[model samples]
Target: MKEKNANSQSDSGYQRSLTNAHIQLIALGGTIGTGLFLGVGNSIRRAGPSVLLIYLVVGIFLFFLMRALGELIVSDLSKHTYIDFIEKYLGKDVGFITGYLYWFCLITLAMAEMTALGIYFQYWFPHLPTWVPGLITVAVLLFINLLSARLFGNLEFAFAIIKIVTVLAFVVLIAFMLLQGKSTSYGPVSFANLTAHGGFFAKGGIGFLSGFQMVIFSFVGIELLGFTASEAQNPKVTIRKAINEVPVRIILFYVLAIIAILVVIPWDKVSTNSSPFVQTLGATGLHNAGSIINFVVISAAISSTNSVLYSAGRLLFSITFNEKGKWNQTFGHLRRQLPQNSLILSAFMIEFAPLIIIIIGNDAFNFISSTTTSMFLIIWCIMLLSHVAYRKKTPEEELTDFKMPGFPVLDYLTLLFFIAMIVLLLFLPENRIAMIAALAVFVILAIFARIWRKEKTE
Candidate 1:
């Protein structure tokens, strides 16, 4: 009966075309990509079986964080996404920082996915040059995004289905191998691999802690769900279902999938250079397994890249929609009811990703992974803090139905977890550069915000 954010329409008049299926699939597609398929190998190498627990722990905190986000968004159905909530509950300064930081995060992340996509393509055509596919992927997805937001959602649905099929198939293959009592070069395909290494915590506490940086990165895009609130066909029902199922999706897709890989193949045998999923399939005497899995991974990367590009556009548009800043006004404009201005600019930014891959080669993934994990953690911190502030301001009766469990306590604990994660990043040598970079970006954004506010006053 009531219109949520009657004035919340995008400059291009975006339609609420994303159904429950679209939002759910987009959430799955966004979070379950390179992090699980490609990055998990490095995590396995660092933490051994302990990586499973890391996923669980980080996932649990993320659940609380999302719960906080869901309640915030539901409280004002008219609001498009969390950016509005951050601005309203927090301050405009904070809202500005959050919006730009989120945009930057998705841009870098989309680039990372593209980098991985090229590497996967090389698995089939080693001589074709990584940048070739990288560029083409960006162009194709850019075109799709420029057409319509609904098309982007539909494309994500297809990409997500490919990933869902691959992971499901991989898990089934593992079950079949265990049933047959088959053995591979790594020895028996059983759960023994989980403990057979140096015990479950084979790598010790330090190694286990190091994995959190990447583990956190793997879950980076889960918050994309909150951003989709504006386009959701039924925000109340769709957002509710999507956010509620996040933990279960993490368990089934992330936790169970990793466990199955470890069970079938010793963690030590998995190579960071290639996907553990690809590696496991190849290890099962499937000669073309590498090629097959490569195709699947290519699809996964494409899926992730597509979603983030869409996210980057929306984030940029949100900033411009709320402010009169020059760049915001430019990026915020729409044509043919699409954020074409923001979408093309975001795509252009992503084009540089292919160059980064060619320059650094394999290290591109590692660098982007570390940098983004730190950045996403910071974003989560703000999200939770904003939620707390929102709760304090709103009447208890208003949040009656979409209540966040463990409100103040869980909220505080989630914030602490994020702080601990930032501290942990400092101790990690590989992540140290990323930590510094994240800090520098935050400082720069804050100073810029201060100047903008001062000028506005004058």
Candidate 2:
């Protein structure tokens, strides 16, 4: 009944081809992850129940940041990609950096996501070697992204639906348990748990702020909106619709989810290494809830990797297509309605990166988690910095319709939170290495970017 933007159309007449369902899942698939499911305990340990405060702080910053990006996206219909916004508002050099950096983030995280999928799989299929299952998991995502965008969208939609349903089920179970007075053997779980153990601010100022390291990672995929701009069926309405809902989702999914968990489980014994969803559900005496949640997490991991694989390819293709960039057209070739070469390379990076860890006999899951903290933070900082430049350069009227509510203030606030998260990483031994590794990678990329630019100039 709906005539949507067709991928078969050339860029000359290209429009947002993605349906509303695709857009919804694109955001949810990337946002709701094994990280939230499994990692809340580490967060609780990091800041006690104060982790909910961290979620609130970060959530506010992201809301404005997305609004800024949304304003830029809607300013001009032709400016589809985030790169396009940065390019117009910033410059081509900055554009290339955003493109390559965004692609790299996807590649790095995809590696981690694949490794996580294998780890989650082993929870049930213990007899299997990590590499075999990991490789297969990577393959499944690869095939899906290589398929038509609609196919990829359908798969992602289904996967995100499963995640949403699981979380909704958790909320329902929590309400049911509370309503029925399913008292815990240790104690009747209630709001008292928020402070009974150590109080909400038990971590005090530094610990509360530093706890952001884990908290920030949970919000990494919030920018999934920027990636989908080019494909969104109705950019203005869709972009606004997505931005309007983010604040609510962050509260319900992240903030409220934290409160629900802490209410059910005691603070001191929480384990971030496993899905808080699993333990929370299992505590409610729901049979096989843990295994079922693990299954959903594996699917979520695969879905995230798949969507990001496509996004990475698109970014690389954009970089190569621009004459100002160093890469050649062959790498950017658009064929059969897909950036085939870019897709192939993106898939290769995602799959191959993990294979190295598997071959080296590292813990596949830990290796993936290593990139979880720092990589996304690096991208988030760069985006905010880029936005800082963007606001000064672009005409005020262009951004007037959807401009950030508290310019300058919110911009700086988001920056502060991002840095706070980085600082929080130093307090976290578990994720410290990931943070260090991301910085080292950034240094390497910066050096190469200079060389690439020099070569292009020559």
In model 2, pairs of residues that clash are 37-275, 38-274, 38-275, 42-272
Q: Write the per-residue lDDT of candidate 2 for residues 157-176, one digit (tens) a residue.
A: 89888888877777877877
Q: Which stretches of candidate 1 lie over 4 Å from their true place?
A: 1-12
Best lDDT among the predictions, by candidate number? 1
TM-score of each: 0.96, 0.90
Clashing pairs in 1: 4-78, 5-78
Can you write out model 1's per-residue Cα lDDT over 58-145, one digit (the tens) per residue?
9999988888888887777666557778899889898888888888889889888887887787777878777788799899999898
Q: Candidate 2 has what TM-score?
A: 0.90
Which segments of model 2 are wrong by more than 4 Å? 1-16, 184-187, 203-206, 324-327, 356-367, 370-372, 423-433
